[model samples]
Target: MDLANSGLSGEAVYKSTCIACHGGDGKGAFPGTPDFTKSKGPLSKNDAELLSNMINGFQSPGSPMAMPPRGGNVSLTDADLKAVLGYMRTTFEK
Candidate 1:
C-alpha cells in the first residue's frame, strides 16, 4: 500500500481509507457520519471550503470525531482529496 507513490486511484483510495467510515458504497456509517445520498438543498459546497475542511478538519461546533484532519490520513495529497470528493459527488450525491 504505497499511498505515497503508487498514485492510487480514487476508488482505491476511497476503499482503503474512506470505506471504514464513509462505507463501501459511500452511504456512511452510523453514530454520526453524514449521509451524502440524503443531503438536501446543495451538497455541492465550495471546493475550497471542502478542501480546507478536508485538509484541516471540521468540528461544526460540536462534532465529536473532528473529521480527523485530512479524514485521518495526512498522507493524502490535494489531488487525492479532489479525486475522493469527485468520487463522492459522482457516486453518492444523487
Candidate 2:
C-alpha cells in the first residue's frame, strides 16, 4: 500500500498513526484529545477543515493537548489522513 499516494485505508491508517492518541474506539487517549465517538467533537468540523487541521496540526483552543502535523507520522499523505477522518466520521461520528 503506497501511503504516500492514495492508500487511504481508514482502519490501516488509524492503526499506524491515529490510534495512539485517538484510541481504538475513537475516544481519545487523554483529556485534550477529542472524543470522535462523542456527538460534540471533531466530527463537527467539515472535511476540508479537518484535513487542514490533520496536516497542519491542531492545538486545542480550550485545552493544552494538540494533534501534531500528520498526527506526528509525517509519512502519511493528505489522502491518508482524509481517509482516516472519513472513517472516523463514518464509524464514530454517528
What candidate 2 gets wrong by more than 4 Å, as runs, is: 1-5
Question: Model 2 scores what on Cα lDDT?
Answer: 0.82
Query: Distance from true position, residue 53, model 2, in Å?
Result: 0.3
| Tens digit of per-residue lDDT, candidate 1, span 1-94 | 1224435567766887878877876656655665667666124576677768888877644335667777899898877877777767777777
Q: Lowest-scoring 10 consecutive residues by lDDT in candidate 2?
A: 1-10
Residue lDDT tens for model 2, 1-94:
2234567688888988888988998997877788888676889888888888999999877757778899999888777887787678778986
Off by over 4 Å in 1: 1-6, 60-62
What is each predicted model's overall lDDT from 0 to 1? Answer: 0.69, 0.82
Give the Cα RMSD of candidate 1: 4.6
